[model samples]
Target: MNHTIQNLEASFQDVKSENSVLKDKIYSLNSSFYQYNFTYSDSFQRQKQFDELQLLQQQQDYMIESMNHTFQNLEASFRDVQSANGVLNGRLDSLNSSFLQQNHSSVDYITKELQLQTQNLSLSLMELNKSRSEDIETLRNIIRSREQDVPKNITSVVNSLKLNDRYLSLSLLDLQNNISMIGTLLQEQQRIQSNQHKLLQMEIQNLTYSFNKSTILLSNLQTRQETTVAFTAGVCNIPGDNKVFSPGQTVIFRQIIYQVGGGYNPSSGIFTAPKTGLYVIFCTNVAEYHETFWTKIMINGSAKAGVMALLRSSNVYIYQSASNLVVHLLQMGDRVWIQVRSGNHLCSDSPETTFSVVMINGSF
Candidate 1:
């Protein structure tokens, strides 16, 4: 009986030791599970952020491609317009040439006709004068030969001479009237030509204005298409374990996630505006527990926005984060940066302290 009781007590002691060991194993497993869960959560968050960034990039690419397609269409249209204008100009030049040729030919024909008419009139006048002189000589010879019948013959010859004189005066008056009519025709033709030249000048001025307007529009569109700006940077594993900055000190984000149009400089911790435009800026900062982090977004040495991360609790191994966003108009050559305001310490981990800037629209 004593031996059986001693065996039972030994068995009980062994069972207790085994139960304690199993409890320790369970606790260790639970702790490991918690650590793994935290790691998974952190990884998931990072992946989410990465995905968002990729999505943004893809959207930007799509927009750029669409803009390029639109620009191509515009260029094609402009080319067509230019081609049509050239055709119109060619037609106008041909018409103008035809008009000038017709006008010159008409003037030349009128001048030649007037000169020929004048020569004919002069020849007729000369023939008439020669006929009159011959008649007078014949009459005189008759008068001398018939001196006995002088009175009757003389009266008949005088009547004949007066009739010829009246006919000559009527012919001279007709020639003068013809000359006056030719002068009037020339004046009317000159006036018509002047009016046509004025009309052509006005048409040319209108076409020139339209062409200049189209050129300006195309230039503006091209400028808008060519301007593309976006960048994201972070402070990842900074050297020497010093992540603090004095007041008015700029925060340098050494890790470059992405950059487009080349405005952000990691070394200088500043972004120079490549073009005048409206820009959207985002900043995030992280600080350790029991500390405060203060930062501001600066443009040309002036603060545009600010954020604070205050973790005053007596908690160890914890962090607090703050973020700020600003939309501001920037001119080309303007400088932008993030500066420390009050508290100086910032986390050096990737994605925890980040700054990003993107151009929204260009100035008109």
Candidate 2:
């Protein structure tokens, strides 16, 4: 039993190992599934980010181009104003000479206004250049930050996958251990059943030995009682030829032949016990050629012993006989008889087919 248990444990371990390997394969498949999804999703998100970045970069470039165009337009407008002021100054100088003191006050006021307008335009150009430089610097900083964030996000995703893989491996190991434990429990159950069967066999052997001892003691007691016992004997004789019978039908004999006691009843084909005792019952079964028949010794509608006969259908008209002898304990009033269990044409051509019962021992 110990060896069997060990072998079972070894087999269970092997199975556990195989299951562990399968779990590893399953984990690998799951990891692959997760990886595929992550890759697809990350790639999609990265593509979207890249598209957004590209759009931002394009917008920045367009803004820069628009600023450059505005600066050029501003420079052209300043140049046109300078040329117009020079021509106007030349005309004012000619008018002042021609009108003398009368136009001198008006020329001075007009010159001052032109100088103020030129200073305001110069200040606006300087402010526009500064704003453009600041915008360019801000765009550069944004590009640098986005480049740094991409690597950080990728690393985080990879770490999460590794963590998931570890968890799956641990769970698989636990399941494998659980299966191994269940296998051990099953082995214990089988060992228990085996032990129970052995115990049952030992008990049966003890009962049989006790029964045989009691039977021998009873027989010895009957032997001592034999001097005071009355004798009882009965015999049946069959003389018909080619008698057909069906299954479960009693085999009746017309002649009691030699019954010394009132136990035998010819009409009912049965014998009732006059006293409780061990009795030896015997039967001789005869069958026709090429026919098979089954005969059973019955007690109160239940068969106790049986015999089967088969005869070879040869040209010589061969007859066959099967016999059975059984010893049974019967109580007073219990009936014993013989019946045909199976056959078609069963008969007795002579007095060879017979049934008999004799008391072998008296009740103890």
Candidate 3:
């Protein structure tokens, strides 16, 4: 029994010791957990504050940089504006000086010139007045002598001759009415003269054109001995081919194409000279009544020109047409064209409108 009790006591003491050790370990764990939680919370708060402060500093730096950039640009712009203003001011000063100088010089020059002219005019007027006074005095004396010595009987004879002579005088009696009439007549005469001059100029121009054209044609004919080309145009049939034409209805053979040939109709047509000077081309168109058909003497295509018997008043009613033009301005070996124009005309007693031409000789 004693041994059993002793063993039980020892076991009881070991169980108590283990309970104490476990309680101490639990207290140390609780304290460590509390300290760790406090440290973490404080650190978190400090980090948040630092981050906010850093963000604020960054924004401030960005703002400062933008303001600095804006200041630089503004300063450069201000400098440019200042330079431009200075230049403008210089130009304005120069212009003002130039204008002032020019204005003064012009005014002085004009004043001097006007004064000189006034003096010359005054001198001239004085001389003119003196001469007029002398002439009036002499006339007065003559009149007084004539009145004293006149024979009344001869005055009538003198007056008769002078009566018609008064019509030629350049004098005016009525200032208002006659002046208006004279002005109107002058304007009318001026207008008539202007129109006449214009017409004369036009006529001269037309003659000149014709002369130039003729001269050129003659030159071409003489110089260009060889012909270049030729072509055919067409033929015309007017009125009725076989029947007589009615009044106002004349038959026409128009646009006949003719080619260059070696010679004329050796038997039927004769190429004649029309003027004294150089002429070119040998061409003719026919003019006839329905009873007889007109025949054209053709050359090379459409350029022959000259005078013919068709322009007479008696041949006015004769039917005539434009034939192809024949220009024979070429060397001996050269070619030309023969073309016919339109063929038709108003039927009348004499309605001939034919064109013909020929070259007589070379140039002067």
- Specify the highest-lDDT model's number: 1
* lDDT (10s digit) by residue, model 3, range 56-146: 4454345345444534543454354455446545655665666577877776765575566556644544454444345434434543443
Query: Cα lDDT of all candidates, in order?
Result: 0.68, 0.64, 0.42
Query: Comparing candidate 1 with candidate 3, which one achieves the higher TM-score?
Result: 1
Candidate 2 lDDT, tens digit per residue, 1-364? 2232344345334434543443464355446545545554444444454455446445545644554564455456445545655665676577656557557777677667656765664565456445544644554454445445534544554565556556766978999999999999999999999999999999999999999999999997776555222222222334442267898888876565565445777667788887787888888887767677788999878888888886545554666668898788888898898888888655554556678888767744
Q: Any runs in candidate 2 off by more than 4 Å, and if so which?
A: 1-242, 312-317
**Candidates by TM-score, descending order:** 1, 2, 3
lDDT of model 3, residue 75: 45
| Residue 123, model 1: Cα distance from true site in angstroms | 99
Pitting candidate 2 against candidate 3, the one with the higher lDDT is 2
Q: TM-score for candidate 1, please give it.
A: 0.37
